[model samples]
Target: MLNVKSKLQTCLLYFYFLGGTLIIEFNNDEILFLEGETGVVGIIKVAYENKMLFIATQNNEEIVQFLEKDDLIAVSNFKKDKRAIRSQAYLTREENSPLVILNKEHPSTKRLETVLSVGDRVCLNCNITPGTHPEQDVLCSCDSLSGLEISKTETGIKLNQYFDKYTIEKF
Candidate 1:
């Protein structure tokens, strides 16, 4: 049997167990570079060692490579449709790391709404008591903006206030 965790650590690849040869999917779920905030459809592919992802459009051919987990934004799997629901959320893991899901449109959002504030430091805790719901269990803390608005983007969590100036530390 292949060591799934070991392979993931080295390549940040996701194995979709397809019976024979493992089908490794490159997690290119987010498109970081777009013109004027327009959304772009990310290319998806299955790759193996020595074989990279390739695509051919009507007039262009492109070959792309994958990056390590640390070099990319964490992946997420939302259970609901974000477009229709307005606040759909899902959890996903990259490179065998702790799973993180967006925390929008959840009933628990009301619970966390009171705790978050502007300037207050927030940490995402994956392993809390009762691991029944990973999304609800994760925690965020901050010192200011007691009623901070929670939003989701291609990257990750988006606070209503500007977080560019503050240094965010994740555990």
Candidate 2:
């Protein structure tokens, strides 16, 4: 079964084509650098929230080939229209390793309006969870974690005022 799956994956490499933007998913765990792909396809980030996997292709030039994002492509999104580009707001993932989707009956899975700040930068590909630290809880999405750094504290989730990869200060 594993061999068949791997073979099938190798056959098809296309992942997402949202609003004219192409988001490629690597069939293999390791990324293959094709021509023009040396600096185009950024790292792939996966966040487990609400028992669903949220995937995003980052364009940040810092960690392109040097540090690639981990793979989360074995699973699929559950939504019919899973094209989560700038137009879309949410996406769901299969019950995979990093995430296990909750039933509709679950209160935590309920979708709600996300409050955004004036200059807050969020990943349009992933679902947004407002006012919470994603790493601290499984029911939260890392959409708001695009260019910001977050840390969990006894009081609450702390975020950096500015988008600094190295340092995170009080917001």
Candidate 3:
């Protein structure tokens, strides 16, 4: 019994080591941390072929700022086309996360190009629950130079209408 338990522990430790370490704050200010573990909420799915970073935000029915595998981040305002693949936003990163669209001629393309860049967390039209914990609904990374993050909980948002921009403030 002792041998089996030791072996199990070793395997678990190995798996944990294989991942990475992350500190996440959940709802009610609940904090969780794991060493050598990555992707707790598993927001960004990186396939072997093409990898993309995705994250939804508070009151945002869809993804907020989606950084493509190539380092281009797309910003969307949840109006018109709500999905990150649709709405128009430039992150304001280099005048754009270059804007994600396979078809350059799409109507939203031009809007994305003209949209502004964000220096801080751009919380567009957020209706966070009164008691909602900051860490629960959202998946974010502070280490990122560009302040884009994802939300797991369903944040209330007005569909197809671009709201005013909020500044991404750094503490």
Candidate 4:
């Protein structure tokens, strides 16, 4: 059963890359990267004609091979639709990890918004109660936690308790 689910996910992933429409699953703390931004600077180079599109990142500077039919279509569609590129906003993770894009309307994002409104800490990776913190009570038996706290900045909504990879998803 697990194998079947994995295969299905793989098929969906392939279709998402090759099909006319794209479907993205939403996760909490995601930010949209629109066209013309430095973060999206090199996306067009790789997203051109039926070329194999790899997961693109802001730091990738490798030049891609020549384009194909699909590459032209991808560029044409992108210009025609004016769609924004979406990527996850990770509270904690390695700097070099590939960006994760998600849907803005996904249930998980909505649920996290609700959770934050009530003043609770959730694991950025698991969306469960944070492990433990000095200022916040331990809401679960999660053993790796350090802390979680609300953010005071205008640019962000929340703050992580620790700098480790297993960070708290503040807002």
| Candidate number of the best TM-score | 1
lDDT string, candidate 3, 21-140, tens digits: 211212211111111111111111111123322333334433444333222121322222223312222122222333222232345433432121222122222232211222222212
Candidate 3 residues lying further than 4 Å off, grouped into runs, are 1-44, 49-75, 78-80, 83-110, 113-171
lDDT of 1 at 45: 15
Task: Return the TM-score for each candidate structure.
Answer: 0.21, 0.19, 0.17, 0.18
For all candidates in order, the CA lDDT equals 0.24, 0.24, 0.22, 0.21
Higher-TM-score candidate of 1 and 3: 1
- Which ten contiguous residues of candidate 1 have the minimum total lDDT? 33-42
TM-score of 3: 0.17
Give per-residue CA lDDT, model 4, range 1-171, as digits (tens).
011112212212111212332222212232211122111100111222343322332244332333232111101011212232211111112122222222434454333211111112222222333211221212221123223332212221233421212111111
In model 1, the number of clashes is 13
Q: Backbone collision count in every prediction? A: 13, 1, 23, 8
What is the TM-score ranking, best to worst? 1, 2, 4, 3
Give lDDT tens digits, candidate 2, residues 1-171: 011122223334333324533333342222221111111111112323333333221221121111112322211122211222111211222223122233334465445222111111223123433323222122222333332323222222233333212111111
Q: List, residue by residue over 73-121, the lDDT tens digit for candidate 1.
A: 2111122112211111111121222322223454554433211111111
Summing lDDT over every window of 10 consecutive residues in candidate 2, give the lowest-scoring window. Answer: 33-42
